[model samples]
Target: MAKKTVEAALKVEKLKVEITKLKETKKNIDQKNKQLKKLKKKETKTKKSKVEKIEKKKTKKKKVTQLTERKTKEAKEKEKQKAKEAKEKEKQKAKEAREKEKQKAKEAREKEKQKAKEAREKAKEAKEKAERTLEEELQEQLSPEEIEGFQIEKVNMEKLTNKVCVILAEKETTGMIQSELWKKLKLSSRDGSRLALKLERMGTITREKILEKGRWTYKLIIKKTPISTESIENAPCLTCPVEQKCTLEGEVSPRTCEWIEDWVTIEIKKPKTAQ
Candidate 1:
């Protein structure tokens, strides 16, 4: 019995030791579980912060796009207004130019009308002066003895004054003398008028009369006497074929006569020449 009690006590001691080791192992497993739960919580917090950052960036970009669109619209509106104002200015300038041209044309027409009126007045004054001269010459009557004496005087004068009167009366400037002198002179072709015969003998005067359809017209010329001493001194001693070298020919020879039948007596004051 003593041997059996001893074996039982030993077995009980070994069982107590095994129970203590099992308890220590269970405590280690609980500590590992707590560490895993702490790691999962940290990972969830990091992911949530990254999503919030991406949303904030998207909102900022949208606001910037709206501001850019507003600026572009305002710029286009300003450009349109500038173009409209430029077109209106061009139209106003064209209108002013047209009005100025019209005013210039009106002034030119008025100037032309004034010039026409002045020319008409000058023509009327010229006609009235010619009529008065014709009336004065018609008042004198001629006697047969006086006619004979008058014929002699007419021939001796440098030129035939009556023939000159008839030529002057036919010109446009002296047209007023036509009605007065044209009726009194008998239109004849005979070369033997007492006035013409006396003029032929004098040798100083030349007369040519033309009769056309019962009307008589006359041309009278005067012979010019040159200074003979001056002619001889200026003459060329040598003979030349050229007419310009022969100065003596023009001075000595008879000149081509000009008809001076009715020269108007116009008295003009001589201009003073420097001494």
Candidate 2:
């Protein structure tokens, strides 16, 4: 019985040892499984994060393209509006210019009409004056000698009158005379004398008296004619007798007469019989 009991105790000790070894092996297998599962879960999470980042990048690219396209459209529209405004402004300016040109043309036409009317009135008045002068000349009666010697012609009347007046100015008391004025004028003595007397009566000439060799002589007087300021300033001083005395200082000086007179005497003698 003692031997059997010892054997039984040995058998119980062996069983206990076997059970502890099996528990250690089982714990090591479970730890290995847990490590593998953790590794798998981490890989899956990393892949998901990478996919999300790619999607975000694609969305940003799409938004940038849309913004750029919108900006381009706005720029094109602004340019079109600017071009339209410019065209409108140019059209308005052209219209105003045309209107101004039309107004100017109308004013020019009115001014031309006024000028034509004035010219016609002047022509009519000149014609009437010429007719009256012709009638008066035809009504006058002339002597045979006068008619033979005197004939009026359309000529420079002012020049002829000046020449005759200059010649007669040397003789009468007023230092002026119209003697033979009609003969010089190539007109009838009656008509010429009438005109010359009219000029004298109008105060164009006068009479004066001078003593010559103890006798009183009658002379004609011609009033001085005024010269234009431009002529006085531009006239040459070389021919003046008092040029040396005149100076540019102080007041303006008087100038000598520009014209001088000359006279000649004539005698008529009876013809002598041949000896």
Against the reference, the lDDT scores of all candidates come to 0.44, 0.53
| TM-scores for every predicted model | 0.27, 0.32
Per-residue accuracy of model 1 over 205-267 as CA lDDT, tens digit each: 354443334444344344323223422333333222344533435643223212111111111
Clashes by residue pair, model 1? 164-261, 164-262, 187-216
Q: What are the RMSDs of all candidates, in order?
A: 19.8, 20.2
Angstrom error of the Cα, residue 140, model 2: value is 28
For model 2, residues 1-275, the per-residue Cα lDDT tens digits are 87888887777777677667777777777777777777777777777777777777777777887788888888888888878888888888888888888888888888888788888888887754544432134325533344334323654444444545556555433443233344444666455544443344445555443444554322345553223343234344535566676654623234233321111111113221111
Poorest 10 consecutive residues of model 1 by lDDT? 259-268
Residue ranges of candidate 1 with Cα displaced over 4 Å: 1-65, 68-176, 186-275
